[model samples]
Target: MIFTIAHKEFRSLFSAPSTWLILGVLQFIFAWFFLARLDAYLQVQTQLAMVANAPGATVSVVAPLFGTLALVMMMLIPLFTMRLLAEERRNQTLALLLAAPISSGQIVLGKFLSMVIFNICIIACSTIMLSILGLGTRLDFGLLLTNALGLLLLTACYTVLGLYLSALTKQPIVAAMSAIALSFGMWLIDVGSSDSGSAMRALSPSAHAQSLNSGFIFSTDLLFFALFIGAFLFLTIRRVNNNRLYA
Candidate 1:
């Protein structure tokens, strides 16, 4: 049943023209940035060869692309997630799900899974540009793997938060705006940090994601995203369960 709902949700996303448009535009931007970074790397190759243990194309071009995609995901995830529950509620469809035999957890998990799957596709598309560097240079597969992992974890965080915010209101645009505002706020916390242990920085997903982006994986960073995603999903379940209770 959970798989059924998740599959339905995934297909429903593609049913909209905007989903295709977003993916197309995102890939185009990623390619443009990639070519620019590659061109810059080429221009500096001679200078870098004279330096000791200079960074490679993987570091100079590929890694930064993933980092850029992280910021893009921050802005775009809410648009995909805004309609998850908010649209259902707005269209008077949430009531059917609430009254069904399925638990709120199943419903929430299903929706979250669908969003994760969709975003994984987005990450994969962005990573394709990174993979192209292997044709001309020795790519750092380990670094690429870590960067992809970091983006996936960050996407999970954004999806959970967006889903929770989507549950709070029936207005999809309101949910999108609120989610974007909150995400951008946390991103600011990461940007303003001077200390690694600062409270605000610790709460920012981007702070942890940066470590993985640099190919350094810390257990604490992994735990932070796990707890962050779990807490939000739990809260979403509670919110939807309350709606079921009232119904």
Candidate 2:
């Protein structure tokens, strides 16, 4: 049942021309950044060769690219998630979903799964572009894998957060803006905090992702993402159930 809803939502997304347009623009930006980074790495290759333990192509190019993509998706995902439930509400179709035989958990999880699957495709595409460098240079498959894992978790965090916000309002634009504002605020908390061990900094998903971005995977970071995603998903499910009860 969850997969059924996910398939319907996934098909609905591709059916929209706007999804294709967003993908085109995102790919163009990613490619431009990738080439620019590759060129810079080539220019510094000789200098790096002389320095002991210098970062390789993976560190020099792929890491920054992943970081940039993470930031970009932090803002971009809300645009896609805005319509996940808010648009249905606005179009007066949410009532049908709420009244369906499926549980509220299924509805929320299904929608969340659809968005996560979509983002996995985006991440896979970006990783494939970065993999092209493997032909000319040795790449850190470990770092690449870890970074991909981090970004996937981060984007999933964004999806669930946006899903909850979408359930709170009937206006898709409002949901998008709220998600962006909240996400940016959390990012600011991570950036502005001076103490590395501060509890406030620990609240930001970006902070946890940065740990992975550095090619080190810690269980704590993984726990943070798991908790963050789970909390929001629970909230979204609760919200949907309330809507069902009222409707």
Candidate 3:
């Protein structure tokens, strides 16, 4: 049943013209950044050869691209999630969903799963551009894999928060704005923290995402993401379930 809902939601995304427009803009932005980074790396190749143990293509180009994608995804996810529940409620379709045989948890999970799979496709496309570098020079497969994993986790984290916010209101634009405000506020915590182990840094998903982007995966970072996603999903389920009382 969850898979059925996910499939329907995935198809619905593509049925909207805005989804294609956003994807096209995303591709253009990512391409511009990738080319700029590659050119910069090329310009410094001569100087880098003179310095022993200098950073290579993987360090200069690929990792930063992942980091850039992380930032871009942070900004884009709210738009995707804003309509998940808010639009349903606004259009008066949520009541039908709420009264269905399926549980609230399944509906939430299915929607989340659709978003995750859509995001993975976007991430995979960005990764292909990075992979082109491998044709001419040796690339760090392990590092790329780790960064990809990190992005997936980061996307999941963002989606869950956006989902929770979407559940709070019937106005999709308001939900999008609030989600972006909250996500950006948390990101600011990372930027403001001077100490690596500060409480503010620890609480920010952006901080842990940077750690994973460095290709060094710690148990602590994994734990943070796990707890973050679990907490939000739990909250979303509870929020949706509450609708039953008034339905």
- For every model shown, what is its TM-score relative to the native structure? 0.98, 0.98, 0.98
lDDT of 3 by residue, 91-151 (tens): 9998888878999999999999999999999999998888999999999988888999999
Task: Report the lDDT tens digits of candidate 2 across residue range 49-107.
Answer: 99999989999899999999998999999999999999998899987887788898999
lDDT of 1 by residue, 1-247 (tens): 7898899999999999999998999999989989998999999999999999999988888889898999999999999999999999899998788878999999999999999999899988778768988998889999998999999999899999999999999999999999999999999999988887899899999999999999999999999999999999999999988886764
Q: Where does model 2 exceed 4 Å of error?
A: none
lDDT of 1 at 76: 98
Screening candidate 2 with a backbone cut-off below 3 angstroms (N, C-alpha, C), the clashing residue pairs are none
Instruction: Identify the runs in model 3 with alpha carbons over 4 angstroms from their true place.
Output: none
Each candidate's number of clashing pairs is 0, 0, 0
What lDDT, from 0 to 1, does candidate 1 have?
Answer: 0.93
TM-score of 2: 0.98
Clashes of 1: 0
Question: What C-alpha lDDT do the candidate models reach, one value each?
Answer: 0.93, 0.94, 0.92
Residue 139 CA displacement from its true place in model 2, Å: 1.0
In order of lDDT, best first, we have 2, 1, 3
